[model samples]
Structure formats: C-alpha cells, structure tokens
Target: MDGDFWAPPPDVSPPVPGVSEGYPGVSQVMSHGYFQHGGVTFPGLLYSPRSLEAAREFPVEDDDVFNVTYQKSGTVWMLEILSLIRQDGDPRWCRSVPNWDRGPWLETLLGLRRARANARPRIISSHLPVHMFPKSFFGSKAKVIYTVRDPKDVLVSLFHFARIFRPYRDPGSLGDFMDKFLQGDVPFGSWFQHVRGWLQLRGRENFFWISYEELQQDLRGSVQRLCSFLCHPLSPAALDAVVTNASFAAMSHNPMSNFSLSPGFILDQNRGPFLRKGISGDWRNHLSPEQSRRFDLVYRERMEGPPKNPSGDTKIPPGPPKNPSGVPKSGEDPQGTPKNGGDP
Candidate 1:
C-alpha cells in the first residue's frame, strides 16, 4: 500500500544482474505470468513466492475488514475513508502512520507481521481474486468491501500506473493496453473475471459492493453507507471530516494518504502523482473512438447473463450505456453495443 508492493526489499531477493537497479526484466516481468505459488500463477514482477506463501497462511480475524479491488480502483481512497472512521475523525492520528501501513496489502507480505501486531479491527487490502485468499478466510466472519470501476477507466488508470512503475515498460499505447486488459494479459488478470467472481459472492452476508462512480457521485453518502455496513456509524462532524480527508485534493497533497512520500512505490513523482485525477469517465480522455467501441463490445459480451437473486429475478438487468456522471445501470448492454461514439 504505502511502499512498493511489487518491489520486494533487497533481503527478499538479490537484484537480478543487468536489469533495473531493484527489479529486473521490466517489460518481461509484466508481459507474462512467470511467478507461481499456492498452485496459482501471477505476474512475476508484482508477486513473489514468499509473499504468496504468506498470503496462503494469512490469518483473518472475525472483525478483520478487507478492502478488495483491482489495482487503481480507489484503493487509497477507501483506505483513507476507512482510516478516518476507525480513528473517529482524528486527522492527526490518521496522519501519524502511512495509509498503506494502516491497511497493509494482504498479498505483499511486506510489513504483514506489523499489520497483524497492530490492534483490533485490522483493515487489510488486497488485489487478489476470491480464490487466491487463504482457505480460512472464506469461512471467517471477516467483512470484504469490493470496489469496481468502469473497465474502460480501469484500463486507462492501469496504463498510466504501468508507465510510473520501473518494472513495467511503456506498455505501448492506450490501444495496446486495452487489448491486454481485455485479454486478461495484465496483472490481477481480467477485470471482467475479477468483478464476476466477486459478484458471484455478492449475496454473502459479509460481502458489500461499492462502485467508483458511486463514490464519485456521493462521497459522503458512500462513506455513511460503508460505515453502516462496517457497524461504525459516524456523527455529522466525523462524516464531514472523513469526506474532507478523503477528497482528491486533500489526499493528493497529503503524503500520509497519498503514496507520494513512499519511494519505490512511484518511480518518478515528476511524471504524475499516485492519486492522479480521481474521477469517473477518464477513459474518454485516453481511449480513441474505435477503441471505445471495441471495448464496449467486449464488455457487453463478457458481462452478459446476470446472476440470479433470491426471488429468481435477474440480480442485474440489461440497460443503456452509462453517462459519465452515472453508475452503469447494469453490466449488460440492453440494445447491443453502441456504434463508435463519444464518451458514455
């Protein structure tokens, strides 16, 4: 979270010869799934056997709360919000520790013992899919908050994130990245698969879903709802503090919340801030019209056929494309893929 989860410390493994100073084979590491652990394969540059083994044995307390999402989908934002709630709006205390350390990434293995040794109500984060979690976690009473964003925006964000990391190459253009994203060639695998796997568990008593668009549209309201779900309802002033502290401007400027102060997490701060442009529909700025149309088609196909509700009705229905300001009404495309058009 705070530090580079992908870049293990020198003690984990010696730097590969002829590669980057810390990590080796920048392009090759991400282009293929070369690291295997616990009978699963992951992107080599981002994961290691030691970390995965720790993930396999990671303990999940009854009150443990996990903020799970694919990379760049408001993870830090959620971390800040959850931190504020847990700290009762004590900005000073919240700022005392880095957000990543407050809610350590479950898969990184780095600082995990510190996270466990910390206090009760541990807030953990992970980009791992449902199946990758430790076997005990599934049966535990731990709560999980799954965050999702529009696939298009996710691709754009991931593209920019790759550019900032030393282990990833230029990643070509937005089109190339979009193709990799669609084919599940990038880290954490397919966005569709990740969302779908979590959606399947949507009905679980301990599971909750939060859309990035929903957070954008109503941060305060989302925070309240999350608080209620976590059983940590806040007062008016506390809510305001959480909203203010979690804002893009506040987080971007605050090194404690943002990863800016964390070296190795971001390769070059001059290039861009880690909390860059926290908004919806940013895909419109980066993706071409044809690319958008192609992506829409793939999204519709992958998201077709909704999961069922208890009453036998479709949990989600086909609907029109979402406007930039609105959450996607449904993952399905009711009228089929739209023609090459402007941002939705």
Candidate 2:
C-alpha cells in the first residue's frame, strides 16, 4: 500500500518499507495499496503475486451482477446476502465459500482473476472512489449497489479500523480523526465526493442504493428488494435460510464472514480483526456533544438536499454548510491530515 494513502503525522515514517516513494505533486511517499494519479491518491494494487497474463479473465456477461461498497459499511453483510442469493439459499453451499473469495474487493480481485473466473453470478466489491470504476461497467448491464453510512459512524469505524490494521504510529482521538475526514484526507478521498459522485447517477436503471441501518433492521425485506432489482426472487424457504444465515450473531462467529483473521490478506501483521463491533451508533460512545454538533454541521452542509438516491436508512438530506466552507473557521489543524498511530 502507498504510504501516502494515509495522511500521517510529520514524524511518522512509511509503514511498509520500499512500498512508498516521493511524488512531485504529492508531499510525501505513497504506499503500495494506493497510487497517486492526477494529484489524487487511489486505493489499488501495487503488485500481483502472479503474472498478469496468467490471471483469470472473466466475462462481464451483460448479466445483472454488481459492484459493492466501500469498507466499514456492512460490506460483510451484503457479501453474505449476495452469496446466499447466488446459491439460491443453500445454507450448506453458502457456508462453503470464504467471504474474501466470494465477494472480493475489486482491487484485491485483480490478482485472483483465475479464482474469480469460475465463480458464477460474479459479485465484486470495491472501495474504489466513485470516479475510478472501470468505465465499461458504468452504464452496461452490470448493476451497482452503493451503500453510504452516516459520516459520523463511518469516521468512528474507520478510526478503530486504522488503529488495528493501518500502518501508523498512533490513532488520534475522535476529534482529531474527524478533522482529517472533513478535510478529504482520509483514504478513498472525501466522503462528500464519494456520495455526490454516485448520487449523480441516481435513477439510472443499473444503480441501487441501500443503507446499513435498514439492512440491519430488516434483513428479509432488504434481500427481497435486492432480488427484485436483480430480477431474481428467492423461494419462501430460501428467504428464511438467508435471513437466518445473515444474523449478526451468526455472521460474527462465522470465520468466512467475520474478518478476525483477515488481517494477513492486506493489512499489517499486528492489526486488529476487520470486524470490530459491527454495531451502529458507535460514534455516540466516542464523539462528545460538541464534536457531534461539529460533525452534524459538516454533514448538513455536505448533503444539502435529500440524498439523490435515498435509501430508507438515511433520514438527513444535503444542505448548506453552517460555515460556507463546510469546515471550522479556525483553531483546527492547518495540515488537514490525520495524526498517525495508537488507539483513538
């Protein structure tokens, strides 16, 4: 991963040796998992274990498959749902495949093309910024399901995740982390840009938006709605099985779905399990009233009107910033980057 993928403090060095290098436009060294392009850094593969020529090349098929979401937003749950749908609700079959293999992130899938070619009804996941997807897949028959969370929860989740997985000397407090997130210093670019870029495509036939909270509240209904969009419906018994398999308690314990041991795949050796609490409103426990208000202000300004592709989960819409710039007026970090290392 590119060291520049993260905006570490000035004193911290790159996490993985030889994985980063100085770029002219970029102020610091970039990591292997991220690449700098046009002054913007993107999450991508820096190298493949196998020859690119020998990698599997699957056909897009013009069928109704999907590009899933960015991380920390119920991605695991969505993957399980996709697996169940593809298996037609066979509990045993769903249990057979690991989450990584079944719904691999697009960047990770590049080296595993051979394994991907054989997977039927291909379900690909991504944390690719909305603007970086393969152009061919955008308007074609393939479908897209973009899932967005309340930015507060996203920042909280990402903070904890970075402490465990990302290469940093320290993970700052919620207040400090929020400062970077607001400044578009977080990985995958600005949260507003991510949402706005996709919402721009709302109402398109191949696009669908879902929320993590709604899926948590109504698994069966969410699955049915997703099936309806794909023109695939599960039999009554199959639906029941999918719901049971997707239960939080069940998935939390399932090795395939749970990301406890997944650190070895892409993260540093000492990082924490991928799935932390898997609960909503975690921010309430960490974000103070003042901090919450600040976040609310930013959210209101960034999302002025109702989401262009509003899912039942989100209640807030976009609005003008409390501050015209959508950021605090002063007394904030002028660096506009995250302080690296430690727990938040």
Candidate 3:
C-alpha cells in the first residue's frame, strides 16, 4: 500500500472548465450547480474537460485494480480495504496516507495524473459509469471491484454530503432531493444508471461485486472474497488486522480515512462528518412511506430488467446510450439536447 508515489495537493483554485451546452438527445442536468459533459452531470467547480478526456484515454495496466462505485456507496471503505490487503493487513500505510492518496479519484485532474504515474498493480478508483470509464480497461487483464448499495441509502447519504461538500449546493429538502435523485439531477448522474451499467460487468473473470449491505452484514466474508478476487490472501491474523482497521469506528476516527484533514473550503466537517452512520437501512428512518414506495418502483423496474445472459448483458430502462451501430460506445455521455442547465 505504501509507495514512492506521492500526489501533490490539489490546487487552491482548481480548474473548473467552462462546460459546453448540452448536446441533443441526452439527459442533461445543468441545474443544481452541476453541469453536463458528454451526457453525464458533474460538479462544475471540481472536474474539468481535460481530466475527463484523460480518463477516457488512460491506458489501463493489466495488473491494475479498480475500485469502482457510484457516489456515497462505500468508496473510501473499499479503498481502505484494498490498501490493507496490499500490505497484507498493515494499517501503517492506511494511517499515514489520506484516502485520496491511497487511490485518487480518477475523474479529477490531480487523480488522473496520480493514477497514470503510479506503479504497476496500482489501485485506481473512480465513480464513473461504464460508458465514461477508460476505453483501454475493457479488454485489459485489470481487476475491478465494484461496490453497490441500496440507492435509498445512497440518496440519504448524498443529500447530507452535498451540504458540506464545497462543490455542491445544499441538496435542498429531502423530499425535493428525492425527486431530483430519481431524475438523476444530482452529481455523478443517476444512481439507477450507475448501478445498472456496472452490474453489466458481473461474471467477467476480472470483475467482482460487493454490495454495501453484504459488507455491513459480513465484513470478514467480504474481505475474504476481495482477497480471493485480488489473489492476495492474508494470513488469519493479518486478515484480522485488516478487518479491525477497516471498521467504521476505526475509519471515522482516522483523519486519513475520514475527511477531517480536509480544508474547510473543500470539506466542511463543521457541517457534517463525511463518515456518517455505517449501518444499512438508515434510509428507512428518513424517507416517508411514499418516498420509499417511489424508490422501490424505480429500483425494481430498472434492476429487474431482461434476464442477464452469460455475457452479462440485460435490457434496462434508460439503458446506457449507444452509437448508431447498436453497440455500447465509450468516451461519450447520454445524447442530450438541454432545455436548461441550472438547478431550479
């Protein structure tokens, strides 16, 4: 986990590109302080077109490991687990290095450089959907560990996350946020699309799926599965160390893992800690009965699409946009003709 690679601190004034107008036939959310780039929505102040272009062309090394997830779906947790596994369950690397450095978010400009510069067997993380991911990753021997969570929980988490996160505006009332979420208006685009798109990679030799619910229920088992997937098994004692350090309590307390070390301008820890409750079903407490029902309808409708075949393809509602040739296209976002681009 410890490497000679050291990423520079993010720019005090990071480059936020001037986003172009949304293209025709795509789902564009230029509102809510977000912007459309290649059919996906992103925080305008955080990401740039140059970084995204780099991501599209990043030459994925065969020995690389990718930690992929949608927003607020245990992204940092997975990174910590991977770090521990790389060191055979040593916490020293995890304690000293911030989570972003552990494996930079590949969508950012700094992270893009860090990922490209890292040594082989690198740990690269991203929140990008399949269409937007590096094109080279498709046939590479690289391994991907994707984290899925109940979108309802993701909704609750993202709502709070936007409050303190400098790039996002206050997510507004929970009810309003729910409506926007279902519409895929928030950052990183739609939760349904993200999960559905990545789930399509299941059953591939190099792809492994770990749901937040499953991990919360049996972390040890999940860790074991990860070790098996990565082909880096730990001794029982070492495995114990990994589990102990990666626990929610331990992570929350660690400045490296938590966002406590972040500057106020970037992450306002005063407003909320990045690591909130680690348990599942917290959404139940926050969502009204009506909200829950609506969530269920959307989730079931999309996730329960045409049965997946051996190749892992399934027909999904609002399925990933493709080129006219009828094959999935890389390096593009949804086809969009935007009516407006502001959060109303």
Candidate 4:
C-alpha cells in the first residue's frame, strides 16, 4: 500500500486578478468547492476523514510506486499504464480494475476498507499538494510519477468543467477561467508551484517525471518507459492489453474508465462530466489568438522547461516571478480583447 498523499506546494505568490468580486447573478459563487480567486463568492468546504486511524504503514516493496497527477492531464492514460505494470501487463487485469480506479490513486480507496494493511500494493493517484505528502513517500522506496500538461489546456478544460459541473456557475466565459487559473485560486493550488515542487524532488530514484504532450506523441514508448521506471518487465501480451485499453477511443466512451460517474466522494457534477475532451492542444479551440499569445508569454515566463522523463534530470534555471500573477491587466477582456479595445 502507498502512504498518505501529500498536499501540493504553496503558491509562492499566487496571482490575484482584479475581478469584480461578484457578477450580479454569479458573484459570491464557489467553483469546484473553492472561492474564485478574485470573484465574490467562496466555495464550500470538503469533508475529509481528518485522520486515517492506524492506517497500516505501506510496506516499501521493490521500491517502486506511482503517484498519478490531478485531473486534466492524461491521468486516465497513465492509470492504464500503471495498472498494466502492476498486473504484469494483463489485459484481463486492466479490465478488472477499469480505468478510473487505476492503481496509482489508492488514497481514495481508503474509504472502501477500514484498515490499510488489507490494501494491496497500491499504485495510487492524488491531487494533494507536494507539501502535504506523507513523509513516508519520499526517497527511493516510493516512486512518484508526476504527469503535467500545458496550463493553457488546463485552463480551457477547467472552463468547460465549470460549465458542465456547475460548481460555481461562472458567468464569465473561458476568459474568466483563464484569469483564475493564472491567478492560482483553484483547488490544488498554482500549476506552476505544483510542477515546481515535484521537480524540486527530482534526482532521487523514486521520482519519475513525464509530460502529457510526450505521452500523447508516443503512447507505447511512454508506456514502456513507465513500465521500466516502475521496474515491471512487460511481455508482448501485457503491452498489447495496456495499449488497447488506454486509448482515447477506449476510455472516452467507457463509463468505468471515463470518470464521468460521480464516485460519491467527489461532488458538484450537475454542471459537466469530469472527463471532458481528453485531447491535447484543446486550448486552441477556446483561446483567441491574442489571448493565446498572452498565455504563451506567461507560460514562457513562469514555466519554461519541465524536467525530462524518468530521471527527473534537467536544469531548472532559477527564474523570475515564483507566482508571476500573469492574469490579464485591469479592464482587459480575456475573451480576445476587441480590436477597438473594449471588453467584449
């Protein structure tokens, strides 16, 4: 079993957009259970167990583990990879666990059983900040495979999510979501900080860093690399099963894999399905040219080069603006500023 998932790192100086506290109808509304960064309303609180009573200390077996990332990034894809690795690349096993509950996110399963000892060797998933991770998960024994995606895509996905999930009912369009994301008001904290914290833990044998774009570009290669990192020897049969089930076609339609169903633990799904479009570069459809440029500038300024795969071997140049607060200027319309320059 894996140890308690930790919290993501603190936003060094999270952005706080100068949004009018609340729109007339939608102001003061909470989205995804948290207050909008500059919006008027605050989200409700989550009811955590507070404590896992004598949760069995997860044994450090073979010193390999998987810490899947939060939503939006290719989590489902990676989940299938981990499941295949743990199940010795069995398609039958992949079908058994399904995609949504793939091995990495075991902390969520704690609610299923009373004691941790009864739990299987877990490949768990979580969105907890790096700071909040249990101390036991560090070092060589427990590996954390962190998968990150471009923030532009993440913002777009979150926007659609707010629309579908109705978490806070954002009256502001995708522009507003972009503003909030750059501002760092969402649930798991700033995306930059999340990547930064995990990257900081790099160089250790236990850390395996991969990117969504790279995975999308080379699915099987990525899977093979992941399996190698996890020390799981893959047979041709096992590899075939993992590749087949982890495809977008396979996962997008499958209810069990899609995570569309409310698992009771997560709430506020009346707005939209958790798994929206699982494609990369979807932000291009949402962000206007001008807005996309602004996003690009901000991304280059804040998150330049992510760590390379498996090894976490890369040079992270000490950059400026830990939080960057890259939200648009006051009175600027995020939904593509009008040519005449008035808020759309």
Model 2, range 230-259, lDDT digits (tens) per residue? 777889998998888888777877877776
Model 2: CA > 4 A from native? 1-35, 42-59, 109-116, 167-170, 263-272, 305-344
Better of 2 and 4 by TM-score: 2
Runs of candidate 3 exceeding 4 Å displacement: 1-33, 306-344
Instruction: Report lDDT per candidate.
Output: 0.66, 0.57, 0.72, 0.53
lDDT of 1: 0.66
Q: Per-residue alpha-carbon lDDT of model 4 for 256-279, expressed as tens digits?
A: 666666554454556566666677
Q: What order do candidates take by lDDT, descending?
A: 3, 1, 2, 4
- Candidate that would win on lDDT: 3
Candidate 3 overall lDDT versus native: 0.72
Q: Tens digit of lDDT per residue, candidate 3, span 1-344?
A: 00111111111111111112222224344765576766678887778666777887898899999999998989999999999999999899999988888798899998988887776779999998766788788768998888877677789999989889999878889999999998887778788667666755644667776667667867787788788778887899999999999999999999999989888878988887899898777887898877787776665555555422222333333333333432211112235221111011
